[model samples]
Target: MPRPVYLVDFSVYKPPDEMKMNYNQAYTLSRQWKECVDDNHEFISKVFQRSGISPTESYLPPWVNPATCKEPKYDMDSAKKEAEMVMGGAVADLLEKTGTRPDEIDILVTNCSIYCPTPSLCSLLVNKFKFRPETQTYHLGGMGCGNGVMALSLLRDLLQARPNVKALFVPAEIVTYCFYPGLQKDYMVANAIFRMGGAAILLSNQARYYSTAKYELLHNVRAHTGQDDGAYTCMGWGPDKKGVNGVYLRKDVPVQAAKALEVCLRRLAPSIITWGQYAEAARNLFERRVLGWQVPEYIPDFTKCIDHFALHAGGYAVLKGLMAAMRLPTEKMLPSFATLRDYGNTSCSTTWYVLGYMETCQGIGRGETVMQIGMGGGMKAGINVWRALREVKNVHPAWRHVAHAPVTEADLPRPINDPEAAAAAVPAGDIAAAVKASFGADFKATTAVAAH
Candidate 1:
């Protein structure tokens, strides 16, 4: 039997108010993207109009001057400060909650997609916290937003092999380094949405923790579409026409993400869905493949298997695409939306903020289940299933200051172009028709596959 893994506690870093940037503030900052190019300014303004982020979101590596929107300092010292600001606060809070000493941590894993220095983030934490010299450290780079679940899956495997050991999982991303001052519209959007945030999660296999632990890790499934040309290039780092490096996001990212998520859900349904639902899906597959019948797609009602959903707060477009593909309700996806509105898509740590929101705002009951889905730049999708081990009474640090206010779709600010509403406007059967009309008949099959 596999050893049970439990999440005893977690923490999400909250940046200072000085680092906050609303839509208008971000628009003002976009003027610096190109000091001499008028077209670049217009393009960035257009992207900002379509981005569904609000005016009250926070950022990291504080700007030199908020009034004039001065460019942020990007030297190594600023990088260290960014790390300490997020990682330090998160690790300190998590350790305090779990009452686990630094020396007791058998394993330490840290991930930062674009900011991997010579002395890795794992090393910096170990030294700062004074962990035992024998403590094992692993660093993950270039894995993008999906790395949080990836790190959890790794820790799950490690704990299963080494009993009675505690592990620390840190997921962070520093947007200051990736900030682009170039003229590419694809790169400028990064400035509009990516923000500063990090999370620290404590996992252990000790039976002693099972009683007080908030959740038990049940299942983790990972799917990658990097082999496909469209998926691989959807989001990545590249140089623009002026040879300035930056992260480029293609316009078709949401569509590609929907396809990748569909592949992941197909693999995950059998493991967590009810046996009856699984059997029905298997029957549908058999009829389509063996019986040569044109069977409609089988979309498992995930709401039946999971009480809450912690979808990645990637952005408005990505969230809308996943919601459409899964046929999920707006309520089920509120946490993701709220996180984006408040925190501004903090990369790998975005899922944790969503999870925290679900716990404090949505209220998870004992024995309830949560499905965490993350999609990242690898054109990758990851799913982790966690079951509440007990009713949680303690408020998470991330939600401590947050008001006990309810959120709804009406409360969220609408983007200028509102792709989510546009996607929802088409009838279920006509989704393919709309895709064909938009992206030509050759691309119709791809959209059709994702819709069902």
Candidate 2:
């Protein structure tokens, strides 16, 4: 297996803190589950109660939710309007920075848990940038939050076959549309959590690109736990039989995840970690009774060896689980939480968002390693490790976050460009330009994605 060094994670982003859009607004507007809605101003306290979580036991930090916990906040109108520009612009900017041409791309894969573009994001890239028409492409949907890691796994495997393939992968979610008017606890939970997120990664086995790439794939492990009762447990707010609800975040998410990760990691280790630590975890599990001293289900000590932590800006609890399980310090893990609090959980693209921030603000020095942890249904758990390349040839201009943080691209909307960008360009929403750019000015076709 070829090592996949981290090149550049361009999508790590966080919305401004003052952005007025929040879950409270959606919850209040949602007439469906008014009775179940808890609009208390108690901040994180109310969220814990709603989530049925005990911070003490859960390992959640004090500053996470602050005074208010709401669903993710992104200017949907603005995001949709600029989605094309942001995606294309960022890609263009990345290509320009890396000294790579748009046409050099050999592979493309995209996943949008909420929005599946007609022409598919990959197609848009092909047409807009003139990537080879034969580039392998994939559009993944309905995988929920886990889609991002799944995309990485897919990209890794594809790159293996096409060693020179410059796989440009994107994983994003538009939670704005997912907000349905319902206040059922499940509905409310979805409304309370889940946020807009998107991430992009450039992968290749080419030796030239490898030198600048951040981390390589030491290994990847994926599992599905939402097989039965876990299926609908953690879901997004959409048109369920009852009504529009955000994702249904379940009570069993963490516990179920613990079991799945253990199984997956057992297969990936040996080189990543010593057998002794693994043995400690195994012994602890057997000796610790079901009711004995609370043993954190995960051992992140190995992950700790990695310099940075790029956990999906998942809700506070998920980050805490990894922290407590591995005994990680609060300060060290702040980048992810900070990204989540400010960015509002940009869904699948979260870890990328953090990666961007780290590069600019904290500085992702060369040779530093980062661990990306992802979770979704089936109590699924996916882990992807990255080591920072010696240098980031390119950093997207729109990569800044917060006010003290500069995310000025808010006003610079993305216009549709490059139609024949992907193998097939669907001509709706954002694909109009991609097809027009790649295929031709006259390329006219209705956009259709893998999922509507």
Best by lDDT: 1
lDDT of each residue in 1-452, candidate 2, tens digit only: 55443343344323334333334443344223333334432322244332211122111111122223333233355334334543565566566656777667777776766555566656766777787777777877667666677567777777666655577876766554554454444334433444434556677777866565665666577877656575445444355557554455444444555555555655555446656676876677776765476754444365446677777655544454455444455555666655555454556776776666666656667676677766665456678777666754334333443324532222211111112223123222222122122222211111100001
Error of 2 at 133 (Å): 2.2
Using all chains and alpha carbons, the TM-scores for the candidates as numbered come to 0.89, 0.68
Q: Tell me how far candidate 1 lies from the true structure as C-alpha RMSD in angstroms.
A: 4.3
RMSD (CA, Å), candidate 2 to true, equals 15.2
What candidate 2 gets wrong by more than 4 Å, as runs, is 1-86, 124-130, 231-238, 241-246, 274-300, 391-452
Per-model lDDT: 0.73, 0.51
Give the residue spans of candidate 1 off by over 4 A.
29-37, 64-69, 282-293, 415-420, 425-452
- Total clashes for model 2: 53
> Which lDDT tens digits does candidate 1 get at residues 113-152?
8888979999999889998999888999988788887667
Residue 180 displacement in candidate 1 (angstroms): 0.7
Judging by TM-score against the true structure, name the best candidate. 1
For model 1, name the residue pairs that clash. 22-55, 23-55
